[model samples]
Target: MQILPELGAAVASRRKHLGLKQGEVAAMSGVSQEVLSRFERGKVAEFGSRKLLAILGVLGMEIQFVPFIPAGSLDDLRLERGGGS
Candidate 1:
């Protein structure tokens, strides 16, 4: 459920699949190479949304949010099933 690492992996995989270099992507996305590197490394906790969107744009990708269970929902289900929370 760690979203950042998943996102970073997705970017890195797509970038590689597209045969794109970090420098090229950085320039195209208007982000620094170091920032791109860090993002690809899953160090994106501090990265801004604008920068992330810009990078995704350069990679011909888009971000989407999916609906999911809220906090404690899983625990509630577990307890209902006679399982420990």
Candidate 2:
């Protein structure tokens, strides 16, 4: 999975592991439940990055820009990860 969906899954997993419902997280994060649900499902194609960061903050997470890797390197990593088609 790409980073966004993977991040979403991680957030969902963490929320579930903490015994927090989507509505509770949304309320605590000042986001709508629908938005939170969509985000958790990785359907946030139109969601803003600011809101994403806000949710991450509420989840005790943060986003960071790490060093870049070339597309070829990513492909090689994917293949090594057994994600190749």
Candidate 3:
């Protein structure tokens, strides 16, 4: 959920970095320009994961998930639950 904005920002940044317009991305990825605009605005719920992945592939980006552990007390609890010794 929180990653949506990050993903949008990454897409926007990458597009800009590559000097590509939204139309170019839309054509390359075979997604509608309207959808690409929505994606850039972080309205990711409207698009399917496969379409998003295709668009990202054109941008030379891939999604990666890294497990996140909260700091302080939460981290301790996670470690304990995982049998850390």
Candidate 4:
């Protein structure tokens, strides 16, 4: 699964749902705003897992590993599995 896009989207959505700006999340996660912005937009080539975990921690989010078969993109797989945001 192309986890970066899906994970980024979830983080962005959670951050927005919490009424937070990128800078706030970046500061809380100890990541630069530029990196956070790039990550949110799914433009980042690679991101540190610790940084990602920190962002998720700040957003009160956690990663769940479902049964994934990698049929398509993560979004497609989620849809196929009836996962909701």
Q: Which ten residues in a row have the lowest lDDT in candidate 4?
A: 68-77
User: Highest TM-score among the candidates is held by which one?
Assistant: 1
- How many residue pairs clash in each candidate at the backbone level? 0, 0, 0, 0
Query: Each candidate: RMSD to true structure?
Result: 2.6, 6.3, 4.9, 8.9
* lDDT against the true structure, each candidate: 0.89, 0.83, 0.86, 0.90
| Model 2 worst lDDT window (10 residues) | 64-73
Residue range 18-85, candidate 4, lDDT tens digits: 99999999999899999999998999889898999999999998888778554587887788889944
How do the predictions measure up, each by TM-score? Answer: 0.81, 0.73, 0.74, 0.77
Error of 3 at 68 (Å): 1.4
Which segments of candidate 2 are over 4 A away from where they belong?
73-85
Instruction: Report clash pairs, candidate 3.
Output: none
| Model 3 agreement with the true structure over 1-85: per-residue lDDT tens digits | 4767778788999999999999999999999998888888887665678888999999999888799865657668779799665
1-85, model 1: which lDDT tens digit per residue? Answer: 7877888889999999999999999999999999888888997677788988999999999987789976778878899889985
> How does candidate 1 fare on TM-score?
0.81
Top-lDDT candidate index: 4
lDDT of 2 by residue, 4-82 (tens): 6787898899889888999988998889999888887988766678877888888888877788766667778889899
Which ranking of candidates, highest TM-score first? 1, 4, 3, 2
User: What is the Å distance of residue 81 in model 1 from its true position?
Assistant: 2.9
Measured on C-alpha atoms, candidate 2 has an lDDT of 0.83
Residues forming the 10-long window of minimal summed lDDT in candidate 1: 68-77
